[model samples]
Target: MADSIFKRYLEKKNNLIKNRGILQATYVPDVLLHRDYQIEEIVDIVAPSLNKDKPSNIIIIGQTGTGKTAVVNYVGHELERADAENKNCRYIYVNCEVIDTPYSILYNISNQIITDPNKKIPFTGWSLEKIFNELANYIDDENKIFIVVLDEIDMSFKKNGDDIFYYLTTINEMLKNSRVSIIGITNNSTFAEKFLSPRIRSRLGEEKIVFPPYTPEQLIDILKNRAEQAFYPNVLDNSVIPYCAAISAQGSGDARKALDLLRISADIAERNGDSIVTSAHVDYARQKIELDAVVEVIKTLTDQSKIVLMSIIKTPSSNDTGSVTTGEVYTTYVELSKNLGYNPLSQRMVANLISEMDMLGIITARVKSFGRGGRTKEIDVNKVSNDVFSILSSDDIFRGMNLNQKLKKQTTLM
Candidate 1:
């Protein structure tokens, strides 16, 4: 079956991509475009790790896809190569968003440094204190400099609490010979003041790097540099790169989103058997990329959040209003939870969750004047592809919702 499917795919013509991986945001290039200054500062900050000395704990804050993580990864790669002596130095990169808990983060760091499997802590069941002690012991025994990079560090604090941050920042004090230094990355540039407590803020204040969004011109340069390696010569039209960059710049100036647009455009071109990628391919790719993003975000929401979102989607707005009030959403949520065999949360708690969902860009919650003398917060789901309903509704909890009933319940939300 694999051979037959692959043979058919291989026989297809009009393959536009020379190397699709190059267009992915995850792919780190030896030379990062338009981020030289930030890279220089990062290199200076982390250079001491190569000498088996603890580098300063760094907080890199920026808008999404401004090359914060990429720069850290790039610096880590170079720092490792600089350690030609293999002086028992270690460079560990863990996305805190993935490994959120203090226990799991410590266990992972311990696992990376411990050469003997018998000495490693298991994934669960160990007390966080035990893991921290053992991890510190390993670092002390190994006499290594652990240069740890935690991407999306802000999200970790929000979800799992900053107790982990407190531990990571202070782990070095317990070690006599070995040291651990953090290079934390966050999307919120104001995370230090807004999200972090005073004590936590003090620990992470050792060094700070702010990554600004790319300008349209700078984004175009980045796209072109990546495109040379991502696509075959003459396989992409001249307008494709500019179009993707402009669109991305108008939004968040997100390099990742731009790259995604380019990658998906090439895919659509290849799938449609086109000789070269054009503006039309870019247009369709943008639509697909947006839809995929919405689907992914929906998939990540917790069951309760998903149910809350469903309630909002199902609650029809009255009086030709564009959106329903929080009260209307909670009433509908109560109905949704009961139908799904779950107890409903308090209205106040649901209102708070609604605000969180608003912050997530999943829904637009806003306060506006309702009448000459009244005001209330209104909420409506974001405009997403119709296919998103199917994706969200396919979840086991949502799966039982009859399609006809769903259509009948569909609110005029965008």
Candidate 2:
């Protein structure tokens, strides 16, 4: 029976191919044509001080998907290969988003320096000062030049302030000859400047690299470069690559988003049993990405935001009305707060909460031009009712809520 089926299948003209999207990272070429300006700046910083024993630090500011992380990784790999000849030089990278807080971040660096796995530091329950002192000693003992890359430093600072900055910068002053350098990556340039004290800001001011968003044409080149390796011959529609590039370029010239769009469009094509990805597949993929982003935003929201959203969901005309006024949303918010047995705050506070929700893409607000006589803003429920309901029901905090009943009411209200 297997032989007969194999024979029948072989008789059919087949064009199935392994997807190129699976090899995403490999497909990303090492060339930095569009990012040459940034590469040149970073190289200058590293080159001048490579032979010197004094510690150096660099602060890199770039929006997401402008190849900040990629360029750093690429340069890091090259540095690693060069340093293999001399064991005294070392490079390590940590995404502060993953190792958030001063203690955790310091502990990670300490672990890299000290080879003892059994003496690993705990995530919490230790003072930041103790961790820093211990980590500084560990680095000193290594007697090697260390380069540390801290990606998403903004998130780290937001969680734990400038304490880590103080530790890293001050450690170099205390050490005798052991060199330490930090490559700090952040999406917000103003965040560090505004929050950090002048002392720490001046230390970080030595090397500043700002990366602007990519233009549509530049992004097209990036997409085309990756497409040649990711897909089989003629497997993608001619328009799909440019469409994905244009969409991503508009957002921030984010290469990651562009790559993701291409990957997702190919998956969509395969799901529909199509031989190649078309414009329709790319459009569908965009909708899917939007929904996924919204879902992820919903998942990370605080309990208070969920309560406010649930209140919006309870309203009968929210979907049709586009947005409920701030006052109306406040009323519903109070009702839900009561039902959940939590004390409700004032409308001003609720408005702030609504703004946070809007930032998270849970909802959108429209500012009405009310001829100097009306409210400045109105709240809009931008997401689909079902999507919001699905996300809320998945949360551990909202686990026991009546999802079906609430969603039923919302659907009826539609």
TM-score, each model? 0.78, 0.79
lDDT scores of the candidates, listed in order? 0.81, 0.75
Which lDDT value does model 2 have at 341? 79
Clash counts per candidate, in order, are: 0, 1
Q: Tens digits of per-residue lDDT for model 1 on 1-414?
A: 357757767799646788877987668776778888999998898777777777888888889988888888888888787885777567899988888777777887788888887877897999888888888888898888888888888878888888888998898889999888888889987787887888988787689888889998989999999888877799889899999999999857899988988999899889888899998998998877666677788888889988888787777777464578888888889988998999999988898888887887767888868668776678855452246566777888877577445443333221
Predicted structure 2: lDDT: 0.75
* Candidate 1 TM-score over all chains jointly: 0.78
Q: What is the lDDT of residue 385 in candidate 2?
A: 58
